[model samples]
Target chain A: MTVNVLLLLVIAVTFGAGITLLLERSLTRIVVGTLLVGNAVNLVFLVASGAAGRAPIVDPDDPSPMSDPLPQALVLTAIVITLGVAGFLLAMAYRSQQLQGDDEVQDDIEDTLIMALAERDEASQSWEDDTGGEPDEEGADR
Target chain B: MTTHSAMSFLIPLPVVLSLLGAGICLALGHNARAQRVVGIVTLSVVVAIAAVLLAGAYRDGPQVVHVGGWPARLGIVLVADSLSALLLLTSAIVTLCVLVYSVGQGIVEFGPDTPLSVFYPTFLVLSAGVSNAFLSGDLFNLYVGFEVLLAASYVLITLGGTGPRVRAGSTYVVVSVLSSVVFLVALAGVYAATGTVNMADLSEKLQAVPSDVRTVLQLLLLTAFCIKAAVFPLSAWLPDSYPTAPAPVTAVFAGLLTKVGVYAIIRVQTILFPENHLTTLLLWGAAATMVIGILGAVAQSDIKRMLSFTLISHIGFMIFGIALASHLGLASAIFYTVHHITIQTTLFLVAGLIEIRGGSTALERLGGLAKAAPFLALMFFLPAMNLAGIPPLSGYFGKVGLAEAGIAAGGWLAYLVVAASIVTSLLTLYAIAKTWNRAFWRPPDPETAPPIGDWHPSTPETPQPTGDWPPSRSSPTGTKSGEPWAPTLTAVRQLPAAMVGPTVALVALSTAITLVAGPLFGIASRAATELGERTPYVTAVLEDGSGITR
Candidate 1:
């Protein structure tokens, strides 16, 4: 395949996987999507080395061509790293699901902020009610 | 010793020791005692190797070791220079302190079980990866190092699988993965353009490339690195994610991860692409990072969360030095990186101790800790003052050098850096002071204080019981919970010596750095000199002729 064609394909797959992962709330889908993106990136690296013609080992007796070994080596490392990361991510997801009984991440900050505001409002109302509806501003200032 | 043959094997020794350590840890996974012994022994050996490298760099200059005995252009090479040696030394020291700290904290946090067993091996692997990144002479190897460390971090961050941890870990994972992808894409592009990944070769070759294409590569790489470094606009994920991890994990991450990113950017800017355009961009980015990160710190109520923001902010100061691209600037940047790593980890560890004794990291939930835990308060104070760049601290020396470099680099942009750095320093002080006031000064509420006197001897409440341990029995101390001071005092008095020692050690290190600023500055200057002059690195790798082609 031509290098340009391979580049295009890698870009398409990577972006597709990225968008899919972003859209999904499920942790498993996200991990899978990350894997896809990682593979797509590896493909991009391979393609960038110029369309593969032969293996990188230089055989002096052979009449054929030599491929870029550097990119291949890099891609191999990247793949291993990605696999390790994916395994960890899966473990984390399982653990999360076990703890919360759901895979979806809880929006802790948003929830806490909203709850705190609501509690403050209730407390203010109760204070006013207890003080004969005077709505004491000094205590409410906080 | 001056000859290349003698120095080559020793150049990558630290990384080799660390990797070997990782292997041993993994192999003896079932034997917890053996794992701990191997892990600590290996790290100490690695530290010794780092010392050897530092001495070699000091004596004979920078050295490079090509992996698999290949020439520089064809094979992966690890370079040991003053800068690398300095960072390796700092990393080794911090990791050692953290390892010791983890032994104490891990038992409380993870129990004497499988989780802790799993943790040590991964931690060793992560340290090995970090050492590799510092020593690597090629860009591709650097990327692999980053991936290695990052993979280990993901496991460590979400170890217990608690709800908050999982949620935080997901964000951390996504952000880190995205950054790695971006980094990979950038690497591919650079390789496509240059046909070489060797740092020295790229330094020569990148100059021949067209300005526009170079800029594009520079910006792309910068974007990926900025995300990793948690710089300003890219830093929103850090505060949310970091506060949820186990304290030691957070401490290590805060200490090392972003610094690695900064280190990469520094390498690329000074060694590979010494263009004015990229440096100018870095300058502006540094300013913005400083402002935004401090602002985030100001907004946080949790001690760990606030420190996370401050970590991001301090990264700006390091970047500020690199952006100047002057001797003083680069030297100061290196100094700042080392200083920040020590100070930041110490601060996080102190924060962890606070969470352990006070029951929550949130400032609103803690108070009067100073009276109860004077040592902890002192521990927090040293790093806190150091972080604010108070006079006579290492932080102050680093900032002053950067400011001087900025002034020397004189322009409207330089002035902006000066103003921004000063402002950030002050704001950092403000945020830490807020933590001090609320978490340590204010009186605690008696009703909310954990009961101390009604001791149930059968069951000890784990310091942090979110997961991996049984729920803590309701407070044992019964004083009608009327007075908050007594229980606070009791907990303070009960603070373990194991925890207190590490904090004190870090404080002493910071103080020593401040006291001996001259030697530190000299070392930093040598590092900057070595980094700027790429000839030693290039020559060492390519001289053997095995590195010219793949």
Candidate 2:
């Protein structure tokens, strides 16, 4: 395969996975998506290092091959780091689900703000909404 | 044979010690007491190593060591110059204080068992990461160092997995991940353009690149760093996220994380891409960060949240020093960074103590603390003054040096910095005053107070749900009593000695820095010179001539 074609395929798959993950509400799916994106980036890096080259190992007996060793080394480090990070992310996701009773992350700030505003509006209307001769003390307390 | 070669071996000692310490911490994970001891002993060793490195740098210029006998271009390199040594030393000192403080606070905050056991190892790993970032010579290695620390930080920040903390942690995680991605993308672009990840090699190669391409590289790198540093438009996540962490975690994050970002910018400017258009961009960003950050501080009613905003604002001052691209400016920035780290952490510790003694961190719920706890008041006051750039304080010296450097840089940009510094300092003072009034000076309202029992004069009546004051046990009638309040004062006069000791020590250290500003500034100036001159760093790594063909 041509280097350009392989590079384009890597990019397409990577972005496809990323977009899929972005649309999902499940934390596990999002983590998987992140992993896919990471792999795609690693692939992009490999291609950038000149894809046509042979492996970087030096063998005097074989003279025709030349692979760029630097990208491979870089990719190795990136892969290890990505694995560690992904593990941590999964652990966090598991913990979050256990604690919050849901797999979907809460947009707590937005939800709280909406709830607060609704409460305030309810509070303002409480005095005017009373149609009876006298409001019950317990009902008026809120 | 050269001084640089001898210096290189000594420089990595601290990092190695920290890593070893981290391993020991993990090994002793089942025993909390042993882990604490190991942590303290390991950090003490780090402090010693930092002192040695500083002395060596002072005596023998910059030192560079290539890992595993590889050449500079192909191998990972570690450089310990004046700038790195200074930062390493600051990290050691601040971490030591926080560790001590945590010994007392951690038990209360995290319950003495499993949580703290996890916390110790992670904290050490974070320290190791900071040490690595300071010492690393390869761009890729720098990236690794950043990730090491950042990953640890994510766990620490979200330590308890509480609802508010998790919500905050998610924002922090997403923003941090996005920033890391930007950094990775920039690194990829730089490697593609230069074909080498070695910083010294890239420095020489980057000059040959087209100006426009270089500009793009600069922006990409700086954007990532600015986000990490919590600069202006990029800093929105900080106030929301930072206040949710435990006190020690927040203090360490406030002191160390953004400084690492600043450190990266300083390193890149001096070593790789000196004299670029990025300085102008940094200048504008610094001004915006200072103004916007302090304005955010003004709007906060929570002590820790307000402190978080000020933390972001002060980062602008550090960036301003670097943006000047002059020796004086960079030196002052270094000085300011060191000073700010100590003062900022101390302030957070005091605020944390206030929260422990008083029920809440909110301004509305806390009051008359100065009367209730004199020692806490004193501890909070000194750092507050220092943070506000009061005369005879280390903060003043740092601000003065930065402003002088700014003027010396000589342009409209310099004027903008001066104005921003003035405005930020004044606003910082205003914010601190607000905290003082609400948290210390004002009387606790009866309706909002935590329930109080057996009211002693020393114990400000913890507020009850009712709008009436709790009756004084000494007074039969519910009227005011004439008995002395001295016993109350005696009872609440001191926090546990362990908590009090670290703050007092930090405050004294800050004061000492101010008193010896001349010698400190001289050292900072030398560090700046060593940084600006990249030849020593490059030569140290490449001098063996065993690796590179060219």
Candidate 3:
């Protein structure tokens, strides 16, 4: 199964850029990242089919060693799915923007709550904090 | 010949009926009554169809159907082996119960003024996707099934488009998309290496692929599923996102979605990559997931959030069973998946009831639920105890099965995970007990007493004082978590019979799993045995006769 280096490079670059974008806080950039990654994966199907040949239409008389049609068919399905997901993601991004005036993902409230609880525990248990959250009553010792 | 045609007809009905039901529900959105009827009827029919298919698979062999009259090599196949049938039945039952609960609670209903008339259709669509995933014999079809369910879940998660929901939904959507993309890449790699995505074909074809490429494919596939299944490191998104959705949506997702991921893992490990080179790796993942996930559970102050962590923790048990890679291991894993699905969903539904009764799920804001509503408390108690794997329950049996498998496998890693699983179970009990004591057993906070009979639209309108429920007791500035901080409402009236009925039914079903644990485990072992054999599945799909050339 011979493969082209150029196609490989395209997949590599596109996937790399997409992943970098995906690490951002903003939902718009994440959507762009997802779209880019999706396209790169579609190209993966192409590369997987090896060096491209004639369009995959079966004909007895016109046998020109066509590329595997399966990957192409699969790519079509993948494209439609990606487009649908991208549309839904864009809608969500718009909604998030409307709700809070930005599309950046918020920190998990549960995590924040748990961290606060841990800090509160640390404060109460620590010997350094003589006040222990009651400054007037306990700080006189200090 | 008749039976063959019959199998084909029965195989597609679950997905087809649900989709048709969704379309009808959409068309009848203006008529909520008609829409509800269509949805309920459609799901009820599906449940029956699934049961019939399960009976057939158990009695006969794996039932294989090629869609659109295309032969196995060229077209999609839906195979109802024992495993798929069992899951199909369990999922069908759960989805229907959740729908009934949602309808009774009016959780998924969009009113005349509400712009989104999507709830019924989306719910049905979600069920359709679940059925499709369980039944799909082709890998790409499996992917499509995942997309369908995920797309529906995106709508359900943020149904109201509130600030918190949208925020949660954003994270969920992004994470799920990333996982799907990974799955697609793996699929591309798989096709590049082997020519087919059909599971049966892959079972044979994958053996010829180079070991390194196979390992890479295996890792990518596992990573994709791990994100979906919420295994340890990939699990941070779940507890963060799940508790934000409305209870019914969250319930259904907790019940069915991750199990689908686990099911996929079972398929990949047993069928595609039977060599099981990743046992140590998966065992480590299982141990870490159980310990870390439950630690997070123990740290949570909210009931729903606590359950979310427990859900993640328990996925570890199933993964452990898979890592064992024996008949007992696979059987126990399948059995455990079934048990967890029913118990987890039931617990979430009970959480919803508690929310309605107590007006908040936050432990600080809730107390005396047992005194206020003994029925609701009972509903919560059974599943909560069962989820914690108390003896004489289905959860306990499933755990015992896993521990036995672990002992039989007899590796240091297996022993470690088994110990970790027991500890995880205890931590789960601790979390559930804390929730029980704080939210149910303790007397209502002073601020909540002299209870006003407030009418919450989320519940049936109660006869009482029209005043605002309580005077503000917390700071004037609200917290970002949206937790009330102050005392919410105390239950002074009965929940609607409609709402209570479905929940009772679900609780009863969970209890029924215990009553029939012997037989269900029998079926699960049978399913696992069939899976172990492998030939039944491959031959059923491939040797259908009149098959197209590979």
Superposition error at A75 for model 3 (Å): 1.0
- TM-score for each prediction? 0.89, 0.87, 0.91
What is candidate 1's CA lDDT for residue B411?
95
- TM-score of chain B, candidates 1 onward in order: 0.92, 0.91, 0.92
Per-residue lDDT tens digits of candidate 2, residues A1-106? 2358867687778868775884576667767877777777687676667645556678899887586788778778888877877787677778878877776766
Task: Candidate 1: list runs displaced more than 4 Å.
Answer: A6-10, A110-142, B107-115, B447-485, B491-493, B544-550
Candidate 1: lDDT of B189? 84
**Per-residue lDDT of B504 in model 2:** 82
DockQ winner between candidates 2 and 3: 3
Off by over 4 Å in 3: A122-142, B1-3, B107-116, B447-493
Give the Å shift of residue B206 in candidate 2: 1.6
lDDT tens digits by residue: candidate 1, B11-124: 777777878888887788666567767878888888787888887887777777768876677778888888888889888888877877776665544444533446787788
Which rank order by lDDT, best down to worst? 3, 1, 2
Task: Output per-candidate TM-scores for chain A, rounded to 2 decimals.
Answer: 0.71, 0.69, 0.81
Question: How close to the true structure is residue B271 of candidate 3, measured as C-alpha lDDT?
Answer: 85
Best by lDDT: 3
Candidate 2 per-residue C-alpha lDDT over B1-550 given as tens digits, one digit per residue, 9 for 90 to 100: 2445666677777778777888898888677678888999999888988888888878877677778778788788888888889889988888888888777665433334533556778888889899998899888888888888888888888775656666677667767766776677677778777788888888888999888878788888888888888988899888878887777788889989989999998888888888683677788888999999998787666788889999999999999999997888899999999888888888888877776666457765666787788778888888898999999888998899889988888889889878999899999988887678666765555544433222333442222222111111111113223422333233433355566677788878877888888888888999888778878776766664444655
Task: Quote the positional error of residue B202 for candidate 2 in Å.
Answer: 1.3
